[model samples]
Target: AQSVTQPDIHITVSEGASLELRCNYSYGATPYLFWYVQSPGQGLQLLLKYFSGDTLVQGIKGFEAEFKRSQSSFNLRKPSVHWSDAAEYFCAVGVRRDDKIIFGKGTRLHILP
Candidate 1:
């Protein structure tokens, strides 16, 4: 089975500061990684995903993630975060598109003024 872990349960960043959220996965083979954001009372929104091709993938809302095979990590980063970026971030891993995706516990992002 595949699993994902988000080390940080909560993260706080200034309104315009850079942000990085750690994500690690445990899988025997190359697995698909996805980053999703959920605002308060909102549904999950796909931020970025890593399946194949480039290791570094860009996502919506000025977010990007780098897939490190050796480290089994797919960390998400943003140059400058906005107040609206505050939400719950999730890391998911799956073997195939049709397979069930396993999500992390989720990390709550806090925006500080």
Candidate 2:
């Protein structure tokens, strides 16, 4: 079985400050990883994904993540955050093609100006 765990349930950061979210996964082999953001009452949008190759992957909205095989972790990082960046973030792990993706409960980000 494959699973993903997001350590932080919620985070608050000041506007223009840096941010990081932690994620850990358990899988048999290299699995498809993705980070998504959802605004209030809105659907999720893909921030980034790691299918294969490169350990470090970049995504939209000034977000980036590094895949560490040894640590079984893929952490999201942003140099600076904006008020608009405040949203719910979810980390997912995709197994088989026909298998359903699993999403973490999500971390609510609050930005203070």
- Looking at candidate 1, what is the lDDT of residue 16? 98
Model 2 C-alpha lDDT per residue in residues 1-113, reported as the tens digit of each score = 78899999999999999999999999888889999999999999999999999999999989999999999998999999999999999999988765778888889999999
List candidate 2 stretches off by more than 4 Å. Answer: none
Candidate 1 overall lDDT versus native: 0.94
lDDT value, residue 97 of candidate 2: 63
**Using Cα atoms with residue i matched to residue i, what is each candidate's TM-score against the true structure?**
0.96, 0.96
TM-score of 2: 0.96
Predicted structure with the largest lDDT when compared to the true one: 1
- For each candidate in the order shown, give its overall lDDT on alpha carbons: 0.94, 0.93
lDDT of 2 at 46: 98
Query: 1-113, model 1: which lDDT tens digit per residue?
Result: 67899999999999999999999999888889999999999999999998899999999999999999999999999999999999999999986746888999999999999
Q: List the pairs of residues colliding in candidate 1.
A: none
